[model samples]
Target chain A: MGPPTLHELFNPVLFYVLLTLGAVGVALASPRKGVSPQIIGGLVVGAAFGGVLVLLGIRGNEAGDLPNLYFYVFALIAILSGLRVITHPKPVYAAIYFILTILSSSAMYLLMQAEFMAFALIIIYAGAILITYLFVIMLATQAPSEEKVASLEGYDSTAREPLTATLAGFALLAVLTGMMAHGMSDLQDSRQVIRPSVHSLEAPILGVLPNKVIREFEQAAVFDHGIAEPTVEEVNDGFDANLRTMAFKIEDRERFDHGLETDTRFRSMLPETIHGDTVLVTLPAERGITNAEGVGFTLIAKHPMALEIAGIILLMAMLGAVVLARKQIELGEDEKAAQLRTLGQGFDDDVAHVGGGM
Target chain B: MITSLAHIAEPVTTVAPDIFGDVGVSLYHYLFVSATLFALGVIGFLTRRNMIVMFLCTEMMFQAAGLALIAFSKYHLNHSGEVFVIFVLTIAAAEAALALALVVLLFRRRETLNAEDWALLRG
Candidate 1:
């Protein structure tokens, strides 16, 4: 893909048309008005959805580009659900819609091959966090009766400042989408961005993996065994296996310094081949390293301090919540008087003295 | 084997740009998705009356940020963006806990979930 073109960034005409239609529909729908305009608004939003993708054109009509379909499908689900979350009269329904938004976004994460984040979104956001919202909604909502659906009754029925809010929200969306479309051409160059290779590793962690264990792999020959193991011949042997290891891109002072910075022991275990300034040491891929491993490696190895700080933040939240939720004990009249008496000392109120004494 | 070590220690050059020209999604697609998600969250946050729902919008915003970070990570082939997502997840979990507790406490006081009803909070 060359640099993005003007049309690829956006369709300005759709922005005005869709915004106008959406704002009008929301205005019509928000006031508990007739259903026709509301339905029309939904349809307009849906059309605008398709229009946004069309204007994007990155995922244009090409059978070859199926991944784009997943993006469109999931994004539509999230967008519609997000709109419903604000528009729905019932708080419980809004919670459910929020779940949809999360699930759809997780699907987007999966498309990007972020398996860890995708599943985390489901288990944490949809599972734990959303369940809490549902419970709160249930606890906070008045029980509906024969006259009304008590579960969803009251202030939730009508949005707060529906017309202005919807207009403002859509305006924000419009500005953002418009900016992404038009403002990003210069920054959106199609440079040949490659996936990070093994050479990117600053740590000799791969170097320290037991040579005996390393020898088991078929592609072990290319591995510069930090010991005096022979470099694999560039013969058809490795070709048959089709398995490759990440080889060092550079072997120099900078790489060694990085190893030392991470850990002296880790740096010390470096094979002579690695420390000797040769870059072709191929680190064998661990058994369970999907793309997520890089993320974990960064947390555990590169940015261990961040992991610890996250734990601290969670601990603090737990403490704060517990403190906030604790019951407030009531004071007896005598106890209250005693408290007031102590306060009187500061003001030096002789007549207001507690226990009727000076 | 020892003789080949010198060759290996230097550069094992990658193929030219055209050599590995595999077509895939661009960085912009992910960015677009993330931006939309965030905007939806912002709209929901502004427009929703339910306190819990508003926080839900905030969580959605966090999700949007995570998506964008992961995509940028993929774009640069770097792991920092992905690792930052771990922190984002942590903060979201923390926010949810504290925010919900506060919501419950507020609801107990006001007996209503409407944002407008809690107007006299400071006095």
Candidate 2:
């Protein structure tokens, strides 16, 4: 028999059962004042998570349809670390776990072939944002005095409303995953199944990148048909006109025309040799559109307004941060007295330093 | 060694579903992960009383949303989803800045990171 489909793999009854188990596990695992049943709860959550993944894997194995092993590994890390991020008692430890979660998420992004976004996630989210979080966590945390055991604050040690939160969260998860598992068949029917073209999504972007195209084709044409490579002198004299003067017949007219309508760059530097089907048509360079270039074009060409808005939003955030940080709030009397004492001590130190200098 | 490395680097050119209605790895797998992450984020945000960690949980939600967007983008064979992730990252950064600044300000006033300290301030 053929393998169990999406519905069978994500059996509603089993899914909900496991989801309930997980929700309970999360509630139990959440940090609490006295002896918390965290380890047992973690085991239950892991078992539940593993049960679903293993079920999916078994069905996937039957169909010979599974993601790369790395996908499973990355997903495991991402989910487990995410759990730890919320469940860990210490705020600093939670932040660290959150970093692990971000790293694994970025790895998953890499697996999904979003190379630009994967690195951007690392750089922006992990590198920049997490550092800010660490800074705030450190700044906000009250330092422990020397005599006492370094204990967690009441808020840090215990979750606020674990049962209600886990129930709400996992119920939403159950609904979402349930929809995805069952509703996929409908989505498949509605979606016009376009034959997956071997040509990449970024293939047309090559036409816009003229200089790279020229550099690539120049060698190929010269090697194959002894077409003269445009000289440095000719390029220096008038690069556009010189490039216009040089053209080659692309063997595949249909494919060239396919990209032609979308790409205006093709219209400007028209291919010189039109009608002949002699040489192979390798006009669009073999090296596909890079992740950065593809994302750059999509950002600049398609969503210029959105990009502008993002910049403005960032600027406003900066201004807002500055305003908030610079605002003076009323200090408690004890803190005000402490501040004054520190200022007085600093003034005395300055006077002592000035006397020493004289 | 080089051949093995090349095998690992083999590119997936397309994601269109095959005869059995499978895109090798079905979109459900990614959606499952994304949903799980997002749910965890919600749980974290709701349960954690540390205001900064609560904000961190919100960041986790943003990360989950970005993952889902990228997955859909891949499923559709489009670049716009990835573009949207860029914007998500931008918003996440802005949020971190403003949220952390607020956290610092609140910490200054109350000298405590507990959310319960400000429970009286409905506004």
Candidate 3:
């Protein structure tokens, strides 16, 4: 009846509940203008989901990697900011949010073990495109006339063309449904890929433990005792039970005896043998690849293409932005000069009229 | 205690008849999230009639697509999903530029930013 395990926190139902709560919290906290509750809710949900994943042993490729959580949080923030770009009324504010979103999404990419994509997302989207958007917004700020403002206010009423919006929404939903169905079908097939083989379980553990101790144990136990070698399952089950007991004892040592037989029981549970006696022990390979060099190798060598494509995409995006933003004035020199003179004359006349009226 | 924790930690493996019963952060979750986002984008696009906001909705769609890709990638344990996401980000940036340029051009032509006022482009 009580909560069973920490992993239950990751249960989809629990995750959904947390998501709903976070969404409600965000909606309540948001200011009364601009972005809808949905966008804010998405941001809050994404951040919380990523945070919970980290806390619940889903961090990176392995469990217990907490720093990666920051990357997900950043991505969520970036996404929120990006959403704000369109939601905000002010162009400057939109640009700011867009920039923040790009930066955060990039951080998310890094967190997902895709370092190259993250940097590319930031450099191209945030550095180039958003700046260009800002420039265009700034340059195009000819104050709207009173009539134009009045029209904009009225536009919202007429804008709700239900037929078109609904049709598009339904179409999107259909496509999403189809895609989701396909994805789930594929996932169902993938369960067969890893069959929880005996070797797969033991190899990782055996790879990590000291070879010298293993050899010494093997010589003493197998050669001397003439006992059949225990299977990987036996070792793992024994180790699991022993570890649980040790953990429980650590929490209440006075209640548990601190003796060699107690330690021997733990040792006998271990799969590895020593001195013809069933020694209870814990294997080491559970902590895979802790060296800095190994970490670097895993990052760079394993996923070079992801990194390269991210870089190329960012570069191309930047170049494209520069080209798009390069202004082309179509006016000839004489026409421009004549127009400026006429504009100047109009300005002077307006200034004189205002001065005389004042 | 460990056994109890294990039971709590593990999701109910047995499937129920409900639509959501089998959905354990699967492709459907990605699609559901995407659809909601796409709907929001559409709503924003239609209701606001502001070119900037419309473009923002388009970005929202792009984000949804990225999310979908990532979810699929996670299911497959492949990097291609992420690669597709990178492409989406690039396309989004390019689209933003073109959209803003068009918005600026429209503003210059009609001397108004309201979409309703810019019917000159209509066939």
Instruction: Indicate the TM-score of model 1.
Output: 0.71
lDDT of 3 by residue, A247-282 (tens): 111222222223323355334334433322333343
Docking class of 2: acceptable
TM-score of each predicted structure versus truth: 0.71, 0.74, 0.47
- How big is the RMSD of model 1? 9.7
Single-chain TM-score of chain A, each candidate: 0.66, 0.68, 0.38
Relative to the true structure, how large is the alpha-carbon lDDT of every model? 0.60, 0.70, 0.46
Off by over 4 Å in 3: A1-123, A144-167, A174-183, A190-328, A331-358, B1-31, B121-123
DockQ of each: 0.29, 0.30, 0.15
Clashes of 1: 3
Q: What is the DockQ of candidate 2?
A: 0.30
Q: Under CAPRI classification, how is model 1 graded? A: acceptable
**What ordering of candidates by TM-score runs from best to worst?**
2, 1, 3
- Residue-level lDDT tens digits of model 1 in B1-123: 223222222121121111111222345556666776676677667666778888888887888888888776654545677778878888998998898878877665445567776654342
For candidate 1, state the interface root-mean-square deviation in angstroms to 1 decimal.
Answer: 8.3
